[model samples]
Target: MTEQIPVQPVRQVHLLLVDDHPLVRDGLRARLETIASIRIAGEAGTAEEALAIAASAPVDLILMDINLGTGNGISLTARFKTEYPHIAVIMLSMHEKTEYVNQSIQAGARAYVLKDAPAVEIIEAIDTVIAGGTYFSSGLNRQTASSDAGQLLTQREQSILKCIATGKSNKHIARELGLSVRTVETHRLNIKRKLNIEGQADLIRYALSNVIV
Candidate 1:
């Protein structure tokens, strides 16, 4: 009798690629498609198109551009989070400024990857986000500093902070804690005011440094 081999199931990630440039989207799709676990569900050439696709497609993750046709990608990210509430988004941009990262995070992006980041880094980011973790490029993580002065955070705020550190959006944290999305948003605002971190990116750093969830 011949011995039987067991076949492991494949975990597929339905990814949505959103960028203004066709070549960029195509290249990214091709690169990611080479991975057996990832599938490009659709591509959008503008923020509006991206949102439309998201509403109609079975997308699990979004690779979104920071600068769309004429709108800011951060705004789109915020809207996408509000509308879908389950889909994860990672910001893809050329700028690595803390402000951009901060805004993107606050807007509910799970990761921030520079357009020129190593291909391996991008792949790692997708894996991290898929695994319910957040990832920022190495350059941003290298900056180490802390400051004191802001509104005092409540315990719930602290809990939410910890969740953010783990790369969870408002929806995920809310679902895990059995809270509403609006309630999560309220807690997020309180965290920002209490930490005085300046923006979304700063909040991510603060959460990483002060809380563990």
Candidate 2:
């Protein structure tokens, strides 16, 4: 005699799609819906709407676009991480610039994927992030490897470089980051030395060329 056992259903990973474009969200929903282990919990067109939805009904992962019309997705990612540290975030952007990728990671995004990437890559990113790992688009990794800039700068140095690129003074960066002016200056010097940048003009040029707008 043989005993029959009931099969248990696999749990689905609930996801929130945040993009300013309706078409983009719809396309993502269509692709993600095909995966048996993934579910679309909600869709938001702005950071505010996303936050509101998440506050009411939490999701396991968030697929967020970098540009959200009037809002910035990177800042939103930081906010989400600050408020809900458990949930993972994967950034979707058109830019493959190393600075953008690094900044997104610093902002608490578990993965940085390009919008034009194949659906399989996106799915792979989702799987990796859900499995407590980080992922970056293949193209982005290639670009980062070619430049060698991302490897040279620490996270704090990257932040300082971004500030410098945006025309912020040392005093402003110090105040904003809660660091002393001397500390900011030291970081600036270290950044220049690491990048082999000689002067303020060269530093700004390097920062402008490397950083994403």
Top-lDDT candidate index: 2
35 Cα displacement, candidate 2 (Å): 1.4
**For each candidate, C-alpha RMSD in Å?**
8.8, 11.4
Model 1 is weakest, by summed lDDT over 10 consecutive residues, at: 142-151
Candidate 2 backbone collisions, by pair: none
For all candidates in order, the CA lDDT equals: 0.78, 0.84
For model 2, how does the per-residue alpha-carbon lDDT over 132-175 read when each residue is reduced to its tens digit? Answer: 65667765654452266666567898899889989999999999
- Please report the TM-score between candidate 2 and the true structure: 0.68
lDDT by residue (tens digit), candidate 1, 1-213? 999999997989999998888999988987899999998999998887888888787999999999887777899999989998889999898886666777787788888888988889899889988877666665443331123211234467777877999999989999998999999987786555334345788788777876645
